[model samples]
Target: MTLTAADVPLKRPTVLVADDEVALTDSIAVWLSDSYRVRTAYDGHEALREFGPSVDIVLLDRHMPGLSGEHVMARLNEMSANPQAALLTATSTDDFRSEVDELGFDAYLTKPISKTELLGVVSDLAAAASESAQH
Candidate 1:
């Protein structure tokens, strides 16, 4: 089926989610389908390959097979228009939070994140993206 403008989540805000967990990727993609143009990548290499450098946001995991979350965030920051990213990890650490933020992820959501929180965050990001577009 072709996607209409109304079908696109966050309007023009395309989001990329890169993680090694297939289940997590599928679940997130399903949850976010109604509101965002969501894409998934199983690893950092795939993330780099698939993610538009101009993508609006990314939900990245802290650990993966080859390239760590830190590494992906590092590379993203080097882009001219760095996409906003959030860390999703089952294990929460203050040190990790510090490190993730240093890489400029917009937020760090602990894993097992609720559907409500995910929707809410996406809503906020969409609004932010809209406002930015107006300016």
Candidate 2:
């Protein structure tokens, strides 16, 4: 039997959640696992280790130890992975908006984000990624 696109299962988009807060990282992972392939990293180094071309979205905490989210993002850019990244941070500085833009983040969300908000952003990013991939 010839398998058409409809006959094959579609691959779920991968989301990488990186935060120094262990609880937050695990919780976000659990929340996203139902809809997307979720990968959790407790630090910036771990985040880079888990990241690759397969990642469609990245939810990164801006203030991680050893290597900040900005550093990770820069490195990811160097690696040529075209994932949509969101900065999930507690920093709400006046210049944060410009910083996020300058640093190349697709979105910036200040923490204590609700599950709804997180899911919505991920869903939107995933959809955009899918659309871009088709082109």
Candidate 3:
């Protein structure tokens, strides 16, 4: 059976990985490249510039030089079709986690994220968003 474009699954999740750490961002972009059209931004300003309505999700580091994740998240939320986002941080404390969650993220993940976990979260979130959009 010859697989055409429609036959192939629609890789609809386009994720933005905003982090100053080049190595880590590259690693994630590489890992997710197969399933998602991943975009990398060095800082918040770049993230804002690169981000658009087409993006499905944003995986932003809590800390960065130009703009903090919190600030970026707020800015993103102001958009018409706000993209689903999650804070990936090494500083995942109970209080901090709760606070970030309260700000309303699809998920909050810790640093050193396993490939399996990242894939699962991205997949589930994308599926849910697709379903919601369809309705």
The candidate maximizing lDDT is: 2
Q: Which ten-residue region of model 3 has the weakest summed lDDT?
A: 95-104
* Model 1, span 11-102: residue lDDT tens: 45788888899998888889998767788999988888877745778888888877877788888777655666688788866765676677
TM-scores for every predicted model:
0.84, 0.90, 0.89
* Cα misplacement distance, residue 107 of candidate 1 (Å): 0.7
| Candidate 2 lDDT score relative to the true structure | 0.88
Q: Which stretches of candidate 2 lie over 4 Å from their true place?
A: 1-9
lDDT (C-alpha, whole model) for all candidates? 0.78, 0.88, 0.83
Better of 2 and 3 by lDDT: 2
Per-model clash counts, in order, read: 2, 0, 0
Q: Compared with the true structure, what per-residue lDDT tens digits does model 2 show for residues 1-135?
A: 799999755989999999999999999999998889988999999999999778999998999988998889988888877788899888684676776677678877788989999989888898889998999
Angstrom error at residue 47, model 3 = 0.6
TM-score of 1: 0.84
